[model samples]
Target: MPADTPTPDEVWALLTHLVIDTRDQWKRAVTERTGLPFSRIRVLRRLRPGPKTVKELAHAAAMDAPAATVTVNHLEELGLVAREIDPANRRQKQVSITAAGRTVLNTALATPDPAPASITALSNEELRALHEILGKLQH
Candidate 1:
């Protein structure tokens, strides 16, 4: 490879940094707009599809059982989530987001990010090509 070209490791490092920065920015924006903690937002996002048990929620949110329980308790107190005994197994609890929670999520997501308008400078063909490349990497 030419000395001027970046190595694969260098490219990966740049991509990793970009992803981390973007994610952190997004989390900050969400918190500022919604006043919800990141842990609660994480669980709320997971519950958008449907209700889930505490164990299932913990796994989805990458949290341990104890942490999930605490977060769920907080969300419950906020009226953002509700819990009920699982019909399939009375021993477990199913957690689901409330309508109020959905409203908060929608409001937070509707807030604009600080993405550069220069991204729109790319031509349609260029954007399509970039989309294809990103799609390939995603799979």
Candidate 2:
């Protein structure tokens, strides 16, 4: 198994597993710390940039519009998010993370984790290589 001749299937499988496991673990940790469902946290993170309509958020989050609406409703109940009338489209509503949501996001990010230190041990060059390789797969 030479470095240049690594098996593509093996690489893809490893990457896939890493992604799923990382997401599940991170979601569990965030939910434990914030007492908010992982789905709600995801919705809040997506809204951090700016307000987005339910349809937009659903598409971005890979969820259906109806599901997004339900999640948004729950988040709204928790005071973590808000819905505003879309000025451009009177019938449409846009969602945004409230100040409370921002605080939750910050707390989630600040929560201690022992895994990151091990991950950070990789040299800058190795990280750059990994990033470059991963970036090529997005297409």
Candidate 3:
């Protein structure tokens, strides 16, 4: 290790800061490019995998039912998502991303991430090391 290598406590602080900063940058980029809120984008992304009920979306998105419904309402108005009554449960509503939603997500993904470009400038060896470290940390 380098003599100036960060201590574990320093590494933890840096990681926390990096996560918050990256999330803020991502939110700015998504909003600037798509004019959609981060929460709505989150819902669309979650729905991209498959149809889900409003409650499911709420739970997954860390939102309450009413908040999820509000977000869904706006997405529906934009024609980016659709809602249908669940056949299995009359009281439930299933939400699914529309073709337009996928297109929007694709466009957003294609947008330049507004985070520090320096992160992407890392050498291949550094990138590999970072990825390996993160993978191990996750478990």
Candidate 4:
């Protein structure tokens, strides 16, 4: 690396591409293992933390509210997710993952590592450095 090279912003763009590419690959692997589309898997994964309104899920998943609702409807049909009336807002509903959904997520997690040993070989320091660098890029 040359000190007189491109500015930090240029390096940040490259770093963003690298991170996105890696995430896309991981999403693809999860989709293949679960037989669920990447979008659906992402929605379910977001709900793992807790139930969320359709609007909240949409924002978290970086999708429009209408699209998120449609996806939630499909998952509902599969018996993987359900909607509950929001206690705070009687007119609103919150989506939550069912036991079946948890089962599917657990199975996906249990799937043997399809990634190469090189990924597993990274030391804690290297992993922390990558995380910190990505965090900076995100901000």
Candidate 5:
């Protein structure tokens, strides 16, 4: 311990706080701009690549099966998603985003977040170093 360095606990606290703050910021902006709730946006994002059963969507969206069904139902009514019976399992409902959903997803994601002063103040070297550290933690 160098006096100038933050202890691990202090670093974790700061990192989690910043992550939550940043997530909340864009979550709100995207929801407002796309006129879709965050849950719907998440469900749409998960379906962008391909269709998934409602159970899969529930796992990806961090919700229970019932909630996922409700969300998918709303998206379907809005023409944002299409639901079909999974061929492999006739009883399971598979959901996929519609063409209009792609448009909304793009529009929602394209909404930019202005860099906060703290980030803007960092030098390229600092940014790279921070990126490297975060990448390590992810692994």
Candidate 6:
């Protein structure tokens, strides 16, 4: 380690800052490109694997039930998602991304999230080291 190695608290702050900053930039880009809120895009991505009940979606998306319902309602209006009565539990509704929703997500995927200036300024060796270190982090 370098003599100037960051303290644990400093490392924590930097990690959290990087996460918030990077996520904000990516979310902004995706929302601007797709004309959809980041939350909706997240829901659509979560549904790509398979259909899920609104409760399950809320849980997976870390949203409350009412928020999920409002989001699902908007997407349903746009025909981006389809909600149907759950055969397993008729009281619950299952939501799935429509073909149009997949197209929107694909469009969102094309949004460019350019590297931050600090990252772009790193030397090739430093970038390689960062890549390796990040890979070693838990998924």
Local distance difference test, each candidate: 0.86, 0.86, 0.88, 0.85, 0.90, 0.91
Clashes of each: 0, 0, 0, 0, 0, 0
Q: Report lDDT (Cα) of residue 70, candidate 6.
A: 98
Per-residue error for 78 in candidate 3, Å, reads 1.0
Instruction: Please provide, for model 4 over 1-110, each residue's C-alpha lDDT reduced to its tens digit, 9 standing for 90 to 100.
Output: 78889988998797676566566666677778888888887788899999999999999999999999999999999988999999999899999999999887876666
lDDT of 2 by residue, 40-122 (tens): 77888899999999999999888999999999999899898899999999998999999999999888877765544445888
lDDT digits (tens) for residues 27-94 of candidate 5? 89998999889888888999998999989999988999999989999999999999888899998778
lDDT, candidate 5, at 67: 97
Top-TM-score candidate index: 6
Best by lDDT: 6
Q: Write the per-residue lDDT of candidate 3 for residues 1-139, one digit (tens) a residue.
A: 8989989999999989887777787778888899988888889988988989988999999999999999999999999999988899888789999999999988777877654666788899998999999999999
User: Clash pairs of candidate 2?
Assistant: none
Better of 1 and 5 by TM-score: 5
Consecutive 10-residue window with the lowest summed lDDT within model 6: 15-24
Model 6 over residues 1-139: C-alpha lDDT tens digits? 7989988889889988987777788888899989999999999989999899999999999999999999999999999999988999899889999999999988988788788888999999999998998888856
lDDT accuracy of residue 126 in candidate 2 = 86
